[model samples]
Target chain A: MSELGFLFAGYAVVWVALGGYIIAVGRRQSTLRREIARLEREFRTGE
Target chain B: MTTVSPGSTAQPDATAAVADGGAGGGVTTAAAAPLPEPGRTLWLDILGVVAILSVLVALYGAIIWAPTEAVMGHVQRIFYFHMPSAWVALGPAFTIVFICSIVYLVKKDLRYDRIAGASAELGVLFTTITLLTGPLWAKPIWGAYWTWDPRLTTTLVLWFIYVAYLMLRSSITEGHSRARLSAVFGIVGWIDVPIVFMSIRWWRTIHPTLVTGEGMNLDSSMEAVLMLSLAAITLLYVYLLIVRVRQLDMGSRLDRLRQLSHLR
Candidate 1:
């Protein structure tokens, strides 16, 4: 592979890793939100 | 006051008790206080944006501005961001270790524990990025993707240790016990970071030792790009840390609110 090809390949890998992490963060945020909503529902019902 | 169970007595207040009971049948009370209101923190956001721009400039500079090395040729460009990322990963890991130490020493509040957790999570993310990118950079330069060199081996160990730290925090039901034990592990694991650096330096290995002012010499433009990328990644780290901390704080508050609502 040409040098430029290798460089671009490296950049692509970096971006993929970054994108994967951002997605994971988003998933965690959603899960936390769901838990919060569940708690809120239970609290309201108990009261 | 009515005679409360050991678990119920430790709850924050009536509101928190109701929320706790409502949320789960047998959830224990936590010592976490109601989260303070988060003020507008534009500094992190601004820094993140600036860092992104700086990284862009660095990328362009590395590829277009700097002259190619006599030996490594085009592949040498990867070193600019790769080394900075390795440095950036250390920043969060060190922060996690420092905060964990403070939390253990003070023991007055749970904020320190939360900070330590946030930093650990961020550290893991950055470390993973470093590990992944390093190999991509290495494949072309080092002629192989994986190396059992001292630096690489120690880095993998450091990454796993933090991964275990997160696992430890999640496995236990949230409370003082989890925080205390994790705090100990966090500090202990951090000892390996310095060992990793030292081992890489003292022993001969393929891992580039640019920081030692050694064989690998960067041109002026390459140096500028590297410094800029480092600054940008550091800003990005700070931004992520703040965002993660806010999320944790919100989750804690939501728990408390749910408990309080149940009490009412």
Candidate 2:
């Protein structure tokens, strides 16, 4: 690959890694929030 | 430490509780599972915006404003993001893990453990970036994608050490036990960071040393862009660390609540 190609690939790697991590974190957070809310509602109903 | 036990008295003002499964069943005290503050959410939102904007500015500064190097040409631009990722990984991210691990051991507090774990995850992420970017830069300049140079080898080892630290954390099930064991691992795993930093200085290597007892090698413009990139990446790391730690803390609380509520 040319030097410019390497540079583009390098930047792409950084962005994809960072973006993928953020998305994974957001997904996990959403799932956890849903579960917590559901359990909370369940407890309230039992009360 | 938010241990769940049967027959304990439930607080009347508990955030969640079941009434009929025995008086105290399915009740967890607020103190045992404290939630993140509402104001902190707003603070995180503002921080997220600032971090994103700073990163964009740094990206522009690196690609456009920074002068091209006479020797390495345009590819040298990779160093702006590449070095900063290494710095954040070795400098702040792993260092935070080392400090938090020590604090967790001393205080036996799970909060510090969660922070340590979160920092370790980010440390691994940034290190992975450094490892990947370094090789991409190396392929064109060094004529090969990798070498057995001390700096590169030590960095690879450092990456594995923290990766193993994370794997160790995930392998265990019990909370305090996992924290205790991983805290020890995190502390010992930190021994590699200094070695990675000093590898180039201590041994003959092809990797360029940007900083020395004298000063950095870059011209003023390159230095400015590098510094901006460093600040941008560091801010991004901090923002991610806060958000990840908050989520991990909430996950821990949810686990305790699940145990209290007898949820599957």
Candidate 3:
């Protein structure tokens, strides 16, 4: 690969890694929110 | 007559205990309420804005503003991002993990453990970036993607150490035990850092050494660009650390709630 190609690959690696991590965290946030809501609902129903 | 007793606070003590205890729900939801989510303050807003701005400026400074090297030419540009990512990863991310791990071991506070774990996660991520970018930069320059050079090998060792730290945390089922065991690894694993830094000086290595030492002088513009990239990436690390730590804290709380519900 050319020098420019290497440069682009380096830049792309940083972004794709960062983006994937952010998405994973976001998904975890949503899952936690749902879990909290479920717990609250269960507590409320006295079941 | 008021339904609530005169001595009762807005939320009942037992209910508050349930929230605090994060487990045991025998009294049920009527006896307690979920804590209100905190409002987003101005600081986080400012941080988010700064994160976006720094990243953009860093990219521009790295790509366009920094002059191409006379010898290495266009490929030298990769050094800007590559070095900064490695700087943030080894310096702030791993150091935070090491310190917080010790604190957790001493204080036995889950918060410290959570913070340590979160930092460890980011450490692994950024190290992975460094490892990836290093090879990408090296391939065109060094003519090979992988080598057993001291810096490269030690860095790869450091990466595995933290990766193992994370995997150990994940494999455990109990909380305190997980924290206890991983804290030990976190503390011990960080000893590799100085070794990684000194490898170039300490051993015969193909990896380039001393960005501004011996004969390889850096231009002022290039140094300034490198500094800017470091500052930007460090800020990015702080921002991500805050976010990940908060997420871990909430995750532990959810775990407690699940346990309590299970008991019911």
Candidate 4:
């Protein structure tokens, strides 16, 4: 592979990994929010 | 009402006291409510967009505009972003330590503790990127992806210390005790930062010390691109910090609202 090709490929891989991480963090945030909401509902109903 | 304490005094009549105190004192007391600031959020969003754009432009400049190094060839391109990532990591790590210290010394507020937690989380993210990218770049230049040199070893230790900080946080139940304990750990962990930086400098190492007091000598174009990339990544760190802090704040507010509603 040409030098430029190798460089571009490395950049692409790093960015792809970064994108995946962002998505994972977003998912975790959503799940945490849902869990809290569910707990709130339960506390209210029990009371 | 009865005044039980020695220094305490009771109003002759509660109703009269309220009427007289308010009219005479001109003090309109209300609940301690926080006001919403829309402009700040808008500015943060704008800054986030600008930071993202700057990073993109800087990346283009690094990859395409700057001439490839004769020795390392294309792999040298990674050094621009790599150094910037390391710089960005320092930002959040220092932020975590500084805020944790303030929180511990001042009001001992858990809000700042939470902020420290968020900062530490983001710090880990950036530090991990630095660690990973360094290896990827080094594998081509240094002939080995891993090294036991002072710079690499100290950084690894620094990474583990912060990771331990997070583990310490999780091990404790969430409360004032947890906050205080974590604050102490955070402060202690930060002492390693200077040690890590100094070890590489004080002793000889294979890692190139590019930006020490001796000065960073580079082509004008190379210097410009490096500065731009550093600025872009620093802005990105700020943007990420704001977002993460907001998310934590929202989560806390939702928790409090739920508790209050449960009481009702």
Per-model DockQ against the true two-chain complex? 0.39, 0.48, 0.49, 0.13
Candidate 1 chain A least-lDDT 10 residues: A38-47
Candidate 2 chain B least-lDDT 10 residues: B207-216
Q: Using DockQ as the measure, which candidate wins?
A: 3
| Window of ten residues with lowest summed lDDT in model 1 chain B | B1-10
TM-score attained by model 4: 0.73
Using lDDT, give the best candidate's number.
Answer: 2
Residue B131 C-alpha lDDT in model 1: 79
- Model 1 clash pairs are B15-B260, B18-B259, B18-B262, B18-B263, B19-B258, B19-B259, B19-B260, B20-B259
Given candidate 2, what's the lDDT at residue B211? Answer: 23
Off by over 4 Å in 2: B1-40, B192-217
Per-residue lDDT of B221-249 in model 2, one digit per residue for the tens? 98999999999999999999999998988
Cα lDDT tens digits for candidate 1, B1-264: 233332342344754555455567433323335443343367766866776787688778777888887777887777776677677777655666567656665774666777788888777777777777667666776677777666676678878988998899999765667778788888777866787767765675555643232446777767777787787777767777777777777766665554444434
Q: Which sections of candidate 4 miss by over 4 Å?
A: A1-13, A28-47, B1-40, B196-217
By summed lDDT, which 10 consecutive residues of candidate 4 chain A come out lowest?
A37-46
In candidate 4, what are the lDDT values of residues B58-167, reduced to their tens digit? 99899889877766788778778777777776765556666666676578866787778777876776677767767776666656777666666666777788789889
Indicate the DockQ of the complex predicted as candidate 4. Answer: 0.13
Residue A21, model 2: Cα distance from true site in angstroms: 0.9
Clashing residue pairs in all predictions, respectively, total: 8, 0, 1, 0
lDDT of 3 by residue, B111-204 (tens): 9988888888888898899899888877887688877666666778889889899999999967788889999988888976676667644665
Q: Please give the CA lDDT of all the candidate structures.
A: 0.68, 0.81, 0.77, 0.67
Query: Lowest-scoring 10 consecutive residues by lDDT in candidate 3 chain A?
Result: A38-47
Ranked by DockQ, the better of candidates 2 and 3 is 3
